[model samples]
Target: MQIGIIGAGGMAAYHAKGFTLAGAEVVGIADPNKPRSEAFAATHAIPATYRTLKEMKTQHPNLDAVSIVTPNKFHASLTIEALQMGLHVYCEKPPARNASEMQAMYDESKRAGKLLMFGFNNRMRPESRAIATYIEQGEVGRINSAQATWIRRAGIPGFGGWFTDKELAGGGPVIDLLHMIDLALYFMGYPEPNCVLASTFHDFMGNASFKGPWGIADGTGKMDVETACHAMVTFKSGQCLTIRNSWAEMNEREVVSTTFQGTKAGGKVERLFGIDGVDETSVDSAVLYTEEYGRQVNRTIITEKDETMGRIANAMNFVKCLMEGEKPANTPEEALILMRITDAIYKSSETGTCVML
Candidate 1:
């Protein structure tokens, strides 16, 4: 399969690598910055570069698919355009800046009859896959309550760049942390979210000690987004999930973990990797707690680093779906639901009241 990347940043490079790893051709790269695009093409050995998707389409008309790794603001427009061009899209998380745009992308994908998948790479992690399989196998029956978090001690990305710009990034860790929330909801079978109550904090925006590793220094750029967020999501099935995400905080350990409580058994998936690599580097693991012979038993499932490359798996799945007519792992419809919940969470935080979905 021949593929192209829509951005020249770190994520776009990552997707290019994944496609190469899957033995697919990365024909072109599209970025507004010519130097960045040229450098990426040189590094990735891609033969073509374009200033925009339109240029890429004109030059590489045989492209089979493209990865949309641009910022939140461009997600909807770029994704819809790619779909309309009859190209399958693998968009980054959050789907779009808002739910309305996400709906348009979804509608366009259906109209174009192409596969649209989100970069829910966390779900493809070996630990996450194991937990999902466990839940599907009824090992953890009917999850009722869950808490998912991705916390960083000082791990903001691009302090004053698009990552911290509300207009470009949409929001802070809440928007960026959609992967963790999506993982929780995915394992919970995607119950309908009834409402959301959320709060955002920007306490560390201008703090020198909290500046993260992704942006420029000197601190002269605008930082209008939150550094931390907390949310409570209620589902129609009477199940609830609490999300806690932060780009900066006063903590020693950093973690991306989720704990699920089910009627039959309880399980936890934990990864010590932080946003800025503060936490210990170890294998991601999932633990199951169950009563065996009237005694509590814990089973640990450890996933090695080589076990799964979620980004690669996602890319391969897209290729396979096109070639074999297989079903997608993450659908645009599911992504739309996630965007609605995310919009509600942000609105609730802004209005200081619960927002109904």
Candidate 2:
């Protein structure tokens, strides 16, 4: 299994490491910035680098797949192009700018008879994997409602970069921190949503004090995206989901968590951070709330700590699905649905009314 990587940013390293760990050779890397691509390739021990995907493919004609780690604006176009070239694609998430783009990518993949998977990595977390098994075994029955949140006390990625520019990054934390939302939906069995009521606030849009510690290069682009978004989605099955996401808020600490209410039991998977994105300063836990012999009980579900937060594991799954016949952890269909819900959330926020799917 030979792979080509798109984008030479921080995430490309993770994909390179993951594919190599899964026994897939990363043959080449491509990025608009040649120096960055070369540096990344050299660091990862990749043999080649190119200025574009076309050039990479021309050089490595037998490349089996490509992992896209580009910005939100490039995900759909690149995925569609890669699939058209007869290569499987593993794209980083917020699937695309809108559902329409996601649908086009999905359609292209099907037309090309290739695989399309997104980086909804939360599904690969140890706690999430365990919770999924419990749900599958009927321990947590019929999830009725869920709340997904990724709130940071002062954790904006950058003050005025692509992340803060709505045109480039799609939206703020609602789209950027969508992992929790996807995780909640995955646990709910990916039900069809009926409608969404959402509101977005830009209170700290350009505040440098809220910048995150990741050190992504800051740009002088327009800082017009939201700082916080709150939304309620009701599903066709009558189940409900509430989403709360913010890069900057008046909170005590950074929290990434999802809690669900089920028929027989309830459960929560959470990570609390003293400083956002620093695993060493983070605490992880999973708990189940249920009754035994009519007595209320709580069970602490323990799992190994994953410092990478499943990012590498998610990439590995994509390779395994193609080379070892493993089922995909996430499908293009699920990604399209996630994007549709995301579109509705933004529309609802703009219209100040419920948006139907």
Candidate 3:
């Protein structure tokens, strides 16, 4: 497979590496920043670089697919364009800025008969996949509710950049942490959200002391997005999902946890990442609790140590799907649902009322 990358940021580099590891030739890299594109191309040994997707398509006509690793606001337009140009797309998560854009992208993919997979690489984790399979096999029975959280003590990413800008990034942790949110929903079988009640806060907008693992803060740019968001989404299946995410918080440590309650058994997956960030194999575990043979049993499963490996697996799966005429596990339809829920979260937070899906 000949693949092209649509952005020259950290994620684009990571995806290019993954595609290369998956036996795909990264033919070109395109970014608005010419220097960044050139640097990424040089580092990856890609033969082509472009200042825009148009140039990339014009230059690399043989490219089989392209990964949209750009900002949230650009996802829809780029994805639609790629699909229209007869190219498959592996879009970065959060789908788009809102549901409407996501739907359009999805519709384009359907019309084009091309693959459109979201970059929810966490779901490709061994532990997460194991849990999902276990639940699907009826081990956990019918799920009732779930709590999904990814909170940090002081981890505002790329402060004053597009990450903190509402126009570019969409929202705060609500958009930023969509991977974890999608994981929770995936475990719940991608239930249709009936309504959402949410609250958002911007307590640490311009705080110079808090910085995450990416981007440099310039101190003069505005942080016009939320830093924290809490939302309760009720699904049509009567399953409730509670999501809590914050880039900056008054806490001791960063935590990633997802707990699910089901009719037959209950399970939880937890990971702790300190000041830097989480590693692939760092402090991750999944445990299930249930009664068997008149005895309580707790089964613990160890997740893969490195997230990068899972990303490689996901990239491989996407390439395999393209080669074998198989559909990807993370389809744009489910991504559309996720985006709808995300959009409702923002609306509900703004109105202080439940937003019906």
Candidate 4:
């Protein structure tokens, strides 16, 4: 299927890189910024470029799928448009800002009779996929409890950029932290989450410690929503999980780890340790631990590949699902559940009470 990407952002670049690696043709990219769009096209050698998504759709009626990599606010609208245009969509995570929007996207896809895949790429990551296998293999007897973190140190995203503006961003670390939340939910077999307790803060919005290269414009930074986020979430299948995430931090690394503690086997599926690096040298090392004969056994680190391995793997997964007329692992419905949990966490933090699902 000919893929037309709908953004010129870094995530767009990642998908293009992956698709190219997977031997998929990226014929066009629709971006508002001509320079950014041209830059992306030049970098990826795309044959066609348009000023907007609608224009791209009009020009490329034969396009089969679109990869939506726009900001949080545009996900649903762009996805709905693509579905209406008779194109399957593979959108990035936190599929929509809230359940209402997500459900609407799902409904549109259902009516269109097309596939809508959420870009939960970690579903195709090596260690993440392996750990899920381990759990099913009874390496972890029964995952009763789990704890994960996406905390950052000195990690405030572009201080005055869209990331700090809740209107543009939807939320702070909550959305950024959702990769872990979704992964943990996937690890837990995606049981129905029963309730959520959460706490959010704007305390670090003005903290200069978080201002590294991205200097704040004024004494007060433009920070809406929670700077630091924490959530206590429960699932109906007797599974409970704790999540910690922050984009505003003092140090530079992304997060600590996802410590998988279950009834039997346990490990960490991290970008560094557990995550097998399929990209260049920087991403190959991962944090992984396995328990064997009562001994905590750390497994051998995964190797890195030179190609657009990770993203292409994800693209192939989506293509295979589309070819077989089946939903990919990261379907819109599954992504909606994750987004709902994310929304509930934010709501719970605001009310300072447990939110019922």
Candidate 5:
């Protein structure tokens, strides 16, 4: 598989490495910033760099796929364009700025008959994979409810940059840190949501004290996104999901977790970060709760720690799916559903009423 990278950002490097590791040739890299593209190409030993995907395609016509690591606003447009050009797409998360855009991307992918996968990396983690196996085996049967949270203490990224700008990055932590929500939905079989009731807060929106250590460049743009979002979603199947996400909030440490209650048992997969985005200071755990022999039982699941938190692995899966005909880890259909839920959350927050799906 010949791959081209769409952005010259930090995530583009990760995809380049993952594609290379998966035995795929990275033909070129593209970014509007020539210097950044050139730097990224040089670092990855890519043979070419272009200012746009069209230029990359014109130069490397044999490119089989492209990885999009650009901003949230570009996800739908780029994915649709790549699919229209007869190339598969591996897009970074949030799917798109809104559900309608996500739907358009999905429709185009289907019309183009090309694979369209999104970056839901949390589902690729070792512990998550293990828990999924247990779920499949009925260890955790018929998940009735779940709680998904990605809360941070003073961890807002680029306070005034695209990340905090509602138009650029969609919403704040609710969208940026939606991995847990997607993971929980995946665990619960992606039931159709009935409605959502959400509340968003902007208490620490422009506070520099909440800036994270990600080193993302700060922008002088409007910081209109929320600092925190809490919501509850009810599914038509009577299952429930509660979400809590925040870029900055009162918390002891950064907590990223998903807990599910099932008819047969219950389980949790979590990462406790001493410092946000610093893998060396993170601890991971997966545990299953059950009853055996009329006694309460708790079993800890042990798996190798993924310092990258499945980012690289998720990219590698995209490569394998294209090259080896393996099923993709995620699909655009799932992404559209996630995006619809996200849209409802934002709408509900704005209207102060339950938004029905």
Candidate 6:
């Protein structure tokens, strides 16, 4: 497959490398930043580089697809455009600012008969998949509720300006650190969420002065987006999930994690306190501690895989679907549901009421 990247940022580089590892030729990369684009092209040994998607599409007419990793605000427009141009799209998550825009992109994908895959990387973690499978297999029996959190130790995106800006990021931890919702939904097989209520806070911006992997934010950083979001999501399955996402929290360690609360089997972070026995293998994502049969039992499953694993695995699945002429795992239509719930979270935060799906 001949792939072209829509953004030459760090994620685009990871996508390019992972694609290469997956035995696909990264034919080119397109970015508005000429210097960054040129540097990426040189580093990846990609023969083609362009300043715009229009030019890339014009140049590489044989390109099979485009992997978009631009900001959240640009995802919908770019995805629709790429789909209309007869290209399959594997776009980075937070697909749109709102559900309507996401639905439009999905509709266009249906019209174009192209695969549109959302990048929710948490789905690929080995432990997460294992436990989720176990839960489905009745290990968890009937699930009642779940609570997930992505907490950082005063770790606001002290990096690029795009993240803190509401216009560019669409929202804060609600959209950016949304893997918890996706993981919980995946474990629940994408249950129909009836209503969502959330409260968001921006109190930690004063402690946002720090170095970050994507670089640093300079000057007086005005965080116009939410730094924390605590939401309650209710489902028609009678399952309730509490979601906590925060980039700025005074905590001991960062949590890239989630949990599933069930009647038979409940799970939390697999191995929180250093690896030992089953506890160690579960790593950060999953932890199942069950006490039954007149005994205390603890079975840990470590999730060491990073977010990129899910993105790449989902992409590969999408590509296979394109080859087999079938629907993908993370389709644009399904992603619309996620986006709608996300919008409702923001609406609920603002209105101090539950936003129904």
Worst 10 residues of 1 by lDDT: 274-283
After superposition, the stretches of candidate 3 with alpha carbons farther than 4 Å from their true spots are 215-221, 278-281
- The clash count for each model shown is 0, 0, 5, 17, 0, 6
Clashing pairs in 6: 270-286, 281-302, 282-301, 282-302, 282-303, 283-302
Question: What digit string (tens of lDDT, one per residue) describes model 3 on residues 80-188?
Answer: 9999999999988778988899889988999999999878888887778778878989999998999999898778887678888888888888898877788888888
- In candidate 3, the residue pairs with backbone N, CA or C atoms under 3 Å apart (3 or more residues apart, or in different chains) clash, namely 280-305, 280-306, 280-307, 281-305, 281-306
Looking at candidate 4, the ten consecutive residues that score lowest on lDDT are 273-282
Cα lDDT tens digits for candidate 1, 15-86? 777777766788999999999899999998999899999899888889889999888999999998999898
Q: What is the lDDT of residue 38 in candidate 3?
A: 88
**Candidate 5 segments whose C-alpha is farther than 4 A from its true place:** none
Who is ahead in TM-score, 3 or 4?
3
Which of the predicted structures, 1 or 2, would earn the higher lDDT when compared with the native? Answer: 2
| Model 2 alpha-carbon miss at residue 321, Å | 0.6
Which regions of candidate 1 deviate over 4 angstroms?
A: 214-221, 274-280, 306-309
**Candidate 4: segments with Cα more than 4 A from true spot:** 206-208, 212-222, 250-253, 272-309, 323-327
lDDT, candidate 4, 116-150, per-residue tens:
88777766666677667777787677677778787
Prediction 4 TM-score vs. true = 0.88
The 10-residue segment with the lowest total lDDT in model 6: 270-279
Q: How does each model score on TM-score? A: 0.94, 0.99, 0.95, 0.88, 0.98, 0.89
Candidate 4 residue 32 C-alpha distance from true site, Å: 1.2
**What digit string (tens of lDDT, one per residue) describes model 2 on residues 216-327?**
8789998898889899999999999999999998987899999999999999999998665687888888899999998999999989998888999999999999889999
Q: What C-alpha lDDT does candidate 3 achieve relative to the native structure?
A: 0.84
How do these models rank on lDDT, best leading?
2, 5, 3, 1, 6, 4
The lDDT of each candidate is 0.83, 0.92, 0.84, 0.74, 0.91, 0.75
Q: Write the per-residue lDDT of candidate 6 for residues 241-285, one digit (tens) a residue.
A: 888888776565556667776778787643242211122333454
User: How many steric clashes does model 4 contain?
Assistant: 17
